[model samples]
Target: MAEFDVVVLGGGPAGVHAALAAASAGLNVALFDENASAGGQVYRAPLEGMRAASNADQQAGDVLRRELTASTVTTFFAHSVWAVTGDYRIDATGPNGPVHCTARALIVASGTTERVVPFEGWTTPGVIGLAAATILLKSQGVLPGRSTLVAGCGPLLAAVAAKTLEGGGKVEAIADLAGTADWARTLPAMLARPGLLRQGVDWWRTINRARTPRYGRHTIIRVEPADERLRATLAPCDAAGRPISGQRTTVLADCIAVGHGLTPATEITRLLRAKHRYSRAAGGWIAVADQDGRTSRPLLYVAGDGAGIAGAAAAATHGALAGLACALDLGAANPVRLTRGIGPARSAHRHAARFGHAMANLIALRPGHVESITPETIVCRCEDVTRAEIEAACDAGARDINQLKAWTRCGMGPCQGRTCGDVAGELLMRRMGTASRETVGSFSARTPLRPVTVEALTGNFTYDEIPIPKAAPL
Candidate 1:
């Protein structure tokens, strides 16, 4: 069993900064990432022999990668931590083989994934998540399709549209659930970070230059196969995302890239039994943590998107704070080291969080949107569970998400409810007339958190002879 002073999960901006901070403070740290490389989804590295467009954001990721390599932190790439137990013990499978590790303190910075709300024909071959499209374009230098329609909420819509155009892919249209009024309302909070505002302006300018048709307060209600193309039905929506009785439009698209912002990847956090609360603005259920990233569990911390939906800037700041706090807690560093520069980092985090909150509010999914799900629409693609099936389970007296799971197997798929849990919970909430979605409860996390083949587990198994106890005297 390998051990370290600190174990940081994930290799994104947050984990990188945390490892650097702790290592520089004279603490041995091990950083584990599932990817073959360090960069997370946002700042993912391009494939070999493929040159990605140079930018400040990518440059920052490069700098972090270099610093991590130069630091004393031990990095394990292609390592997926499937289970954690007994204080901070971790079971993972790395490129070489299975690894067992323990740490005095643990920092989770696992980041976020696209929050998907299923629509009719969403399981069609041409449909993909906005994050998937971004990865395909940026990392693999592959276009999602020749002509695509980018739909859904949040800043990612515009970002994906702009990236598609830059990659020389024709964008049929860009549909946003938020209208002009939404952006106007969020302007004050967005102004907290002038750079982010400027970046938004730049993305808008790019889309404008492409002359792509941009729709506001609109959503793709359904999609159908039309030969090799996809026919998407678009309709106007109100503030609550309820469809309005207005003229609808249809577009022929080769691909549909859609997403409803992001939700924190909280499987590991939930498995750890850390306290959490539901906050739509924070991207659903998130680990309850303080400014220093300390969670309810002692010596266990969370930072980055795993803690909440704050973007990379805030994630890095929180990571630094958490690292300092961990070092101080372990007596590995002086108290002055923990206090130094923390004030500025916290202030910066606040500014970034303000902008993140503003963006989240603008793109938050309304209840009506979930109500719009058709009975036939597939909610859990992995399990082939439809809205009708879930509704039937609820009608059969399944009161909460866990009961509904046993009744219909909606969240018992390979994705482990990552794709369908939120939507299912909302459906259950509506059926039970729960005051809040949280009342329906989140899916209880169990190990192994990720899929692990039996072959791997058995291959790593070792047999040890045990002394048989003599029969106890009666």
Candidate 2:
């Protein structure tokens, strides 16, 4: 068993900042991440020789990396935390044999996951989420294809398109759902943050330069595959996400990127029984945390996008604040100095959060977002379960989320049902009479959550044949 004063459960921006700040305050800290590296999805390493060409993204990432590496915090990459018992117990699997670690205080910054809205033919091999496509490019420096259609409902779609083109992929077009009407409603909020508005303009200018068509009020209705590639049908939609007339068009591409948006990464915190609130504007249910980032649990705290759908700047700021809070709770710091030093970070967080709210509202999922899904669609890719199977589970008296999962195995697959949990719940709720909150339970996360190479798990193998105690003694 290993012990620490603080143990952070993720290596993303929030977790990194939390670990570093806590350590700087004179606490022994360890950061555990399930990935092979620290950057998580946003700061993912760009392909071999290609770095993140964007000046803003790169600078932000560099500062974070520096702060983390400079601190006394020890980081454990490729280690998965399976379960947590009480306020301190964490069962993690790593190079060590099912290592058990206990910390006086725990910080959860697991971040968010992609929110996929299923549609007909969505499970076709060529269809992927905006974040998943970004992961592929950032991790391997490879594009899904030469010609790609970026169709999604958030700023991430724009960022992904830019990154795709930068990596030598040809972007066919970008069909965005943020129409002028929606922007008009969002204008007041956008004007509140001039700096963020400027950032938005810069991204638009880059998109314009690439000649990528940015359509507003549009939705993808159908995606057909030809010769093992994808062809998508798009049309204009009103604010309610309904199809408008006379705007139907078909686009040809090898791959399509689509997503509703993101939800807070709250699995670890949910296990701790932290309170959660459903804010459609905040991308869905998120942990209900206090201003200082403290959760309901005395020794447990949460920050960043995991607590809510905030951006990188907001995440870093909250992370720093939480780290300070953790330090104070552990009796490791002088009250006055910690309080004074936290002001600037707090200001940054407020500024970033204001813009984050605006962005979140602007990209809220449309009312009829699930219109594209058909009965034959595969909602849970890991389990190969179709929409029909989910409905059957609901019809068979699996009224609650857990019951549905138990009956149909909707979320009982290898991906831990992350891919299908929400959608399955939504379907289950529609079929049954349960409330949405009651129908959607947390995804099951086990140790070694991500698949690692067999060699990595067996590399330390040593065969020592222990001889049976000789019966000669008997």
Candidate 3:
């Protein structure tokens, strides 16, 4: 029943900045976040009862929180927004109960999801994603494990390795998909944002000083629980990430954190039916938007990794730009202020994005990676669906993800295709001999977008008032 001029989805750097900019322009704004605090993964706030540390990233987040507190923006922290309607009816399960809001314009800065390719033990108990390990280390002050093997691509490999070392964990080794030469190429792009680049360099140096055996151009081909620990097979990878038949070494570690960069969470954009294009190497399906973040839909905007896989710096600037652009479009901004802010924000955005975009491009899923999935390897963890099932679905004439889900139950999990959709679609595309993911279109996002309890949704509505959905036609 509440209404506002703008409602921002996400509490990351992008959402925070967008709300700040929009509120500064004299528009009513409300920000919703899944966290108890404003910071997202990168600048995640430590859990309550943990001592707050003073660092550059933490300092930046502190400044943002202070600004948010002082602003007129209504904040909805720890809200699980399950559904956003076409008419901008926002439904969320808040701390107390059901909450609803509407807005004239909406900005989705919902950030990214870790991209995972199926392997032998991806679904095993202790094998976690970089995102999980990040929360363990950054937010909870807990070591991922006594001995952890960090396996993945992009900047997070170095960052997590460094953080694990800082948290007093033994880094068994780092199995990185990209070689040193690849990072050398990415270095020039990162140089544009010296502050962020310096942080990356520090991470690299920490792991290097620790003498962690960084297996360059290598991948964790297999993993299995050994005793109370885990044993992983690290194999050299070809340029396309296919396992080379040469030497492969086994490392025993208590924990394994693995992921291949991030995929922009495009569920909102796709659900809104905005113009989108497929670029697997860049990102999967990104909403088509101008430089200022205005999407094909006039009332909708995308910022941060939701639009594309940019880092926090780019996300913040891009958010500022989106908020200001939205203000200008809505005739809410002061002409003088908009003119002053837009140019600097745009330039800074481009500068920071170069580094982030390069990192994102480096982690692009190679052709051989998905092809190497063993038949028994589970692709969808939620449903225990295997690669063999996906292939069988393809054999039985499943043309797209939706059809594949229907045939093999691949994307019909609690995550709602967030984790396995990309890998599943990639497998289907290879079978169909198509390079474009658009060929085997993405899963249609079902509403009540995430899992919600019946009690939370039903509220005081009577049985007759409770809407029942029609069954799908056979």
Cα-based lDDT at residue 382, candidate 3: 87
TM-score of every prediction relative to native: 0.95, 0.89, 0.95
Q: Best to worst by TM-score, what's the order? A: 3, 1, 2
lDDT of 1 by residue, 1-474 (tens): 999999999999899888888888899999999987777887788887888678766787788888888999999988888999858998998767788899999999999867778888999999999999989987898988999999999888888888888889999998888899988988898787888788788888999998999888898899999999999999998887777888898989999999987888888888889998888878888988889899999899998888878787788888888888788888885668567757877887887788777877865657888888899999989889999999899888888898888888888988889888888888888888876977788898888888997766656444565456799999
Backbone Cα, N, C clashes tallied per candidate: 0, 0, 0
Q: lDDT of model 3 at residue 71?
A: 96
Quote the lDDT for 219 in model 1.
Answer: 81
Candidate 3's C-alpha runs over 4 A off are 458-474
lDDT of 3 by residue, 434-458 (tens): 8778889988888878889988876
Tens digits of per-residue lDDT for model 2, 1-474: 788999998888888988888888889999988886676677765554665655565566667777777778988877877777665777666776566788999999888878877777777788889988878876777797888999877778777787788778888888877787766776776787676668677767777888887778788878888776688989887776667786687888999988877877777777677777766777766777777688888879998888877777678788888998888878986877877768877887887787677677766655566544678888888777888888887777676777777777777776676677766766766676555554455554444444445555445554675345667754
Q: lDDT winner among the candidates?
A: 3
Instruction: Rate residue 212 of model 1 by lDDT.
Output: 94
- lDDT for model 2, please: 0.77
Each candidate: what lDDT? 0.86, 0.77, 0.88
